[model samples]
Target: MGETSLRRLPLVIMLLAAGCARQAPSPAPPRVETAAAQLPEQSSAIVVPVTADLRMLERGLDANTPRVLWTVDEHRDTCVRGKRVDLGIGKVKLTPDLGCRIVGQVTRGAIRVAGAGERIDITMPVSAKIAVRDIGGVLGETATARAIVHATGRLGVTGDWQPRATLDIAYDWREPPGIDIAGQRITFTSRADEKLKRVVRRLERDLPKEVAKLDLRRQLGDVWQRAFTVIELSKRNPPAWMRVTPRALGFGGYRIEGRQLRLTLAAEALTQTFVGRRPADPTPTPLPPPSRVAGQPGLRFFIPVLADYAQLEPVVLRTLRKLAAGGITLTGIGPVDVDFGKVTVYATTGNRLAVGVTARVVPRDRDFPATSGEAWLTAQPYNDEGSQLVQARDVKLAADTDSTAVDLIVSLLDATQVQRAVALALRHDFAPDYRKVLGKAQHAIGARQEGDFFLSTDVTRVTTGQLQVTGAGLFLPVRAEGSARIDYRPR
Candidate 1:
């Protein structure tokens, strides 16, 4: 071969070698981070008021008691001593000399029921009239009497949430009726008293039947089911929800006010908060037998301040892209240029966050070739006390394939610039969200009606909790403590 041709062959070999180096295959993408975690459950209360209208008992009394309670009819003769005549028998037998006929009737007027502490008082007015027929031209007379039937009723709730009343009934005479003839006074109180005994028995038997009309069990059941709900704290930005699951039932006792009896029912529940899409409401369970509950029942729940991993991706990508725009310098390698591909953020084990970055890196150094692959980094995010700024510490770096090319890129990731950028992306201000959440929640808990029950709530205080990293996102638990009450107002 000629010398000039051999020289040209060397240049061609050099050009072919450069093309082969640039055509090397790119490394595979890194695997995403995985973690299993759940937010802590909190305790809360759902209070229900079961009310019974006592006017029903009044109507029942009016319907059950007859207007004409009883009637009395009797005829008797009393012998009168004739003037002392000559030859009159010394001890003449008491013979009928005066004829008397008495007829009487007892009738009820109106019934009224009123509340007295935990018990109720039922009162009814009664009137009686007696006519003594004129006999032997003896002046005829009519006697009238007034009386009142009084009953003391005690209210109670059964284990299964049934309302019942027990009545202690009796009657008192305001005016006694009687007749007077020849200094002989005839009283009808004994006969009236006997009739009252029967009336009292009937009232005692009928009170509970009237109380059943209150429908207390149905009211309580509606409250129990309504308590199992998911209350939305915020609609967007960071959609937050609080789930309530009733666990047990408690009896806070009963009170009589005006003409109604109110039974306080407290439901002990487990509350949990979530961020993102709304959570499903808990399935309602049957009303359980009430147990004694201590202290005043109040509402307690958590409102989570969350940062979804998907939301963090864009923020992190923007930071990385801006930093990579000017190119970054490594410790061992002098100056290297980087172009970001995709950024992924998610929770990892030990309450840490995992960030995966895909990039195509070019090195200015002669020994290192241009490389393209994904780099994985893990960090523990934390927020200082009374501060909203979140920063990361103990950042670790890894890759799918370990080599000098990947190590150079990892060194660039170790720079404070990248670390600070990630930390800045994690910086979440909870003040605005906190205030908005509280305001919305307060509005949500306002007095509202569900079925036949009226619900009301008052939030007194809120306490902040520690930060948690779950599979879904970064969650900060904010516990709200308050009081809640539900009244039975049937429509």
Candidate 2:
């Protein structure tokens, strides 16, 4: 071998070494990290349905009916111009005096809600009696009589009643009918003698004072007012956990089908639920404008849940540190350092969530050294019934890594194992404490007592929807549906 050839062999070896070093890609450039977006303050809504049947009102009317409706007492004076009477066997000039009194009562039949133009129609069966006493006149004539009189046999009355009803508003009855006696009949009792009967019929045209005693307005008002009072709903022995405030009441007219009159009642109000304690008395404030009913009649309410990423930082960091302390073994690199850094969360399309994390990977062998990397994970959130919280599920790594260092780390590490570990850690700390917050909210919304009324909420169903990224952490909307009833407990 020549000396020049040996020198050329050394240069060739140097060139080969340079080529080998160039095969590995260059480390990624440092990123100028920006501050993460902050959570916003916002609100969500839920719509509830309300329904009222007119039949329930009828019960109140029946209970409030008075046994005696009316009574009457009347007096009159008469001057006999010329009259001659024979008492026993003597003849005498006589001037007679007269007085009368009558009493009557209204026996009401079934009061029904009439259709469309008519608010309520009722048939009243009336019975009355008459009494007459004639004081002594110039001829010394004194007599007393007791007899039964037939007045209005069956009186049919139709009342046009309008009620005020709206969402989150006050309620009242409008355009109620006045008590009418236009169709009333005036009748006199028949006596055994024709002359005496004729004398009794002379006062038939006079209106019975008992008709004035019937107070239909006051009676009807009591029925409606009692029905529209506060509604109470609760389980036996548990007292009441919730209350509903009915703000307004309105009638949807009525329809007569066969013998039944079906009436519709519209009641608008807000519902509240209590968790730990119950309120002694809670007055109902005017309701806000009600949301339109979508499908059926049922109570509805909205609940907001916030999920903050900051709350999860400590849990995630702890899990990552635990994994790092154990030193994960790689396929070819043996045991390696898996150190995790900061994490940021963001909202994405389709009501989903994304988390970005910074991490470092160091191979056990000093020759490989360590590299910083960034990773992104996408997740879908849902309501976890068992935990009573909204939890992150189906966590997957997003594929848009611009960092070359992160790309190198991906190639050297077991991607599946890392993803699995991260997902498990997220599952542990990715949700808020729903049980605590919701429990407090429920307790705060407890039962209230209005004037002569008790309002309580009866929660039947609770549902949860997907997560929404808003300025206010992770926003989750919850819906609760139930019914509101007003019960009358007189003070």
Tens-digit lDDT track of model 1 for 1-491: 77855654653344335434444333323333433224578776666666657666688777887889889887767423333334465754444466667787889888888866777887888888988775545756788988888888787878877767777888888997776656656678898888888877887777777777666678668777887898887786457778889888887777788877777777788888776777888999988887855444677877666666887789889988888886788665568888888887877667888887877767675445566656677778887764545667777664443442334445556677787777777666667767777888888776788887778888888876677777767766678888876666658
Model 2 bad stretches (over 4 Å): 1-249, 252-264, 268-295, 372-374, 382-414, 428-445, 449-453, 488-491
TM-score of 1: 0.65
Local accuracy of candidate 2 as per-residue lDDT tens digits, 1-491: 67855654653354334334444433332222221222222111212111223343344443444333333344434322235599988968774333333333222344232223223332222233333333222222222222222222111122423222111111111211111112322233221223223322421222111111122234324433443332223231112243444554443343444334333334544445332234344453433222232234555654445555565566666766787787676654457777777766656655556666677777675434465666566666665542345566776655544432224345332355665665665553223444444454455444554454444545566666545554335655455555444433335
Error of 2 at 207 (Å): 19
Give the Cα lDDT of each candidate.
Answer: 0.72, 0.42
How do the predictions measure up, each by TM-score? 0.65, 0.45
- Number of clashing residue pairs, candidate 2: 20
Residue pairs of candidate 1 with colliding backbone atoms? 79-95, 79-97
